[model samples]
Target: MVHLIKTQSSSAKSRMGPASLNPDLPAVAGLGSFEKLNGFFNAIYDGPTEDPPWHSALNLLCETLHAKHVTLILKPPSPVSTGILVNTDAVAHDATEAYQNHFFTLDPFVGLPEGQVVTPEELVGDKVWKQSTLYREYLKPLDVKFLIGADIQTADGIECRFRVSRGGDIPFSADDIALCRLLLPHMRRALQLHSRLDGLETERQLFAGAVNSMQLGTISLAHNGAVIDLNPEARRILAEKDGIQISNNVLCTDNRREGHELQRLIKEALSGSAGKKGPGLVEALALTRPSGRSSLGILVKEIPPSPWTVNRQRAAAVIFIRDPEASVAETSQKIVQQLFGLTRIEAAMALSLANGSTIEETAENLGLKKNTARTYLRFIFNKTGVTRQTMLVRKLLGSVASLG
Candidate 1:
């Protein structure tokens, strides 16, 4: 049988024990008087950077409140989506799946007044709550008797649910409610931080993926000419030890003259001497490969220092290495075709010109007459809005097609 009782007011007048003295109550499981509060706050702020994100904080809350389960609904479930949920390990996978799959819509305990903590018995009469299908079918099966929840609405338009549940006859105490109320604001702020950081991380990954797709080797260098970071392509290039290599964590070439020129360009870039008219101070050189292949094209650009940064030893420059011998991947052709609405032959001609093939050479390579090739080139120029071959080449190289 369901043990139904009216919940007491969470208001200050009815609250008792140490919680009445201070809203932030001390831990009961041998924690120093203030250690639990300190630990919870730390976990709240550090939640955004954690691997599972907010797992530690939720676990601590479950333990401190002496509840069977604590859950943070980062994203609430809807008819179309399962949404994101973070909870303590006390909830079994099958139970969680059942709630998400079926019981979520049947839940009557949702839509609590914003930032107000309340129990089902407090929100609805004890008899109504006990007779509800969510209680008799779901909560009863799980052996859950008491539940307290609060809804948090963030400035970013996120509506999160904070829920705690326990079994047996003991209901949630006023202290538990007070502690949850105290921590709600901190939870909102931490969620905001997590949202912002998550967006920035997603953007970073997108740009990094685009660069990698183009097979562009990017290297970040410190102000002292030491290599600080390298993308996958850069690592592969350096690993080959072809035209350029790393020596003592510094980019260098085996050829003495080329190495001297490389260092000079890096120094000029660092000192803001590489012509500062554009977004980044820029200079370029070609390093001779010992394998008798095409020389590797290198561009050294100064990274503008952040306004808040005063240190010079940080990442101050970036180098871009492009190997002319590397054939354009086939995805680039598809992108060019879709971008300009070009036929296969027209797209091929455009990419050939972009890669430095002469009109006659492309015509012979593709087994087309010179006049026919010129006609196709004209169609490409019309479709892409470029007048001349050089313009077409520049347009193609600088377009999103390169991102493919």
Candidate 2:
């Protein structure tokens, strides 16, 4: 299970990491290139965000090194099925480019020593050279003689190597390897962030798709108070021209007051001093229209970032209407288990009432007397906050349509 990280406020002493985690991580302590990276992490919660920008970091390294070809391998030890993102000033990434098909498989110097800078031979020995005869034959024509490689160990010590090969008879000097070492740690961490961000983006898209398909009005806003995503129902509720218009994350709502209030909450969340990205909560927020109509029983919670790490960006607040007039709660006991913390008997009585069953019929179904069924109905109303059977049907409609 993944636990949500609580970031320290201005009033509290800051914690770099959890007691159980690695204390030496520079990113946690806000040091070095890590400081800039940490700032970027904070920026994610400040507003809507996309995948971690990878090529920019590579561009920084490329400008510093003035290398011919800078390839960031996305796969690990598996040569057969690994992704390679090659950023070269000389070449464009045409769809038909067969780079991944040829170079990675032909490259022989892999399995480098972890946490240490090295040259080609240092990583792959005489025995490897003997085995990679085909690779040598292929390299001779290109005159590629030098490779500066090193294994970048991650925060959890997950080891992966990065190598830059120069196309010349001249060998790579010690200075070149040293520079690679200097940039390796930053590149590795950036790559990890990129991976995590990409994964989160995918999940967000899928989840958004699911939400939009549902009847519930779901809206997810970033810390910056910008509309991140909204379900079809929500879009219908807020959309001005033919549903949604995307200009500065703006929406025309019948209820401008509610819209503005939500925006304020988002702004407050963005301004939070927490190093982690999340919306903690809103204080007594009231969503209303100019007509004085309001969305009631709005429940909000800060959803943590993805449990998986590698590309790290946080998710947004998940808000729902607890006692929805627009939706019906499902009769499924499993949903009852999740929502109201009700027992099986209580859930059954609620469902029966929602189905328009009288006390005698409910008793017949439950193998009980009318008085016993009436007793269960009383408990259900108390648990679900329904005053009568008609109100219970409204709860059933609004609540049952989703098990989110």
TM-score of 1: 0.78
* Cα lDDT computed for each candidate against the true fold: 0.83, 0.53
Question: For residues 1-404, what per-residue lDDT tens digits would candidate 2 score against the true structure?
Answer: 11223343533323433321332332222223445444434432321232223444444444444554555555552455645443435334542144455555566666666656676566567567645753465444344455566666667444555656566455655444544554566656655665566679799778765554344566565644456766666655554332123458743334556656645544544454332443553454444434444344343445445566343233355444321333332335667656776788877766666666777887898888888878877887888788888887677656733443
Query: Which tens-of-lDDT digit does each residue in 1-404 have in candidate 1?
Result: 12222343466323343433443442233233455577888999999998778989989988887889999898888888888888898989888788888889998898898888889988887999999999999988989999999999989898999999999898887656767777888999998999999999999889988887787989999988889999888898889899789989988797899999998889988887775656554568999999999999999888878789998677898899987877654456788899999999998888888777899999999899999999998999899898988899888777788888
TM-score on alpha carbons, each prediction: 0.78, 0.47
What alpha-carbon RMSD in Å does predicted model 2 have with respect to the real structure?
A: 14.7
Q: Distance (Å) between predicted and true CA of 302, model 2?
A: 9.2
Range of the 10 consecutive residues with the lowest summed lDDT in candidate 2: 22-31
Q: After superposition, how far is residue 22 of candidate 1 from its true place, in Å?
A: 5.9
